[model samples]
Target: MGAKLSGGGGSKFHVEANSEINVTPFVDVMLVLLIIFMVAAPLATVSVEVKLPPAIAKPIANPPKPVYISLQKSGNVYVGNELSSLDTLGDDLKKAIGARNPDEERIFIRCDKGTRYAEFMKVMNKLQDNGFYSVALQGEDDAK
Candidate 1:
């Protein structure tokens, strides 16, 4: 019976199933992707050149300095470099602007970026109380 079973088929040596993962193919695929990215990286950047026309305009002779009211983040108010309080803001602004009519003269206001909305509103209220209706918020233009 043993002789018959041996002659019937299979190999003499025992073969076990392979449990370990094969990573050589995975490593090869990753390396190929890395090389492809390296070759394509330099082509992604683009540069363009532009030429702008010269600006030509006549200069004004002796323009009067505009009245500037500045509000600090610390809640301090200044009218033309002079420190002022909310209670006296109107008086101080009027003094700084001289004989100009408050209603007609444009008042420029510059508030610190971190200043509170309430504090800014208080300053505006003070200006309104003093009959100064013409108000302008000052800001830097980014399109230079």
Candidate 2:
């Protein structure tokens, strides 16, 4: 056979750049990372046994129903929803508080925003005159 300088139809054989991405390796790497994280996740959260001391404190009793005093913008006073004038406020408060010690029981005061400071002080004076020293001011909760 005669020596050929180049292979026949060599121009027909050409190399082209592959535009498609090879995702098999990427999928393999991701699967390996997933397995690694799965294996390491449980080991990361190791809990230790804690020895706590015995609780010796006495159980607390149920709290008493709170007593509320409402002062209206109309200058009317209320003791636990019962309408009362400032003249009878002390007696009404005592009756509302029942046999509970006035010195220890807390009396909550809620008032209309339009109520005057003088009117509020009048209710306070009535409570103080009745020997009820534990008075708490009630306000609307803003958390809601």
lDDT of 1 by residue, 19-61 (tens): 6677888999999999999999988876666787787877778
What clash count goes with each model?
Answer: 0, 0
lDDT of each: 0.86, 0.86
Question: Cα RMSD for candidate 1?
Answer: 12.5
| Positional deviation of residue 51's Cα in model 1 after best superposition, in angstroms | 46
Score candidate 2 by lDDT: 0.86
> Candidate 2 residues 1-144, lDDT tens each?
223345545464544444667788899999999999999999999599889999999999998899999988998888887999989988888888788888899989999999999999988888888798888998989896
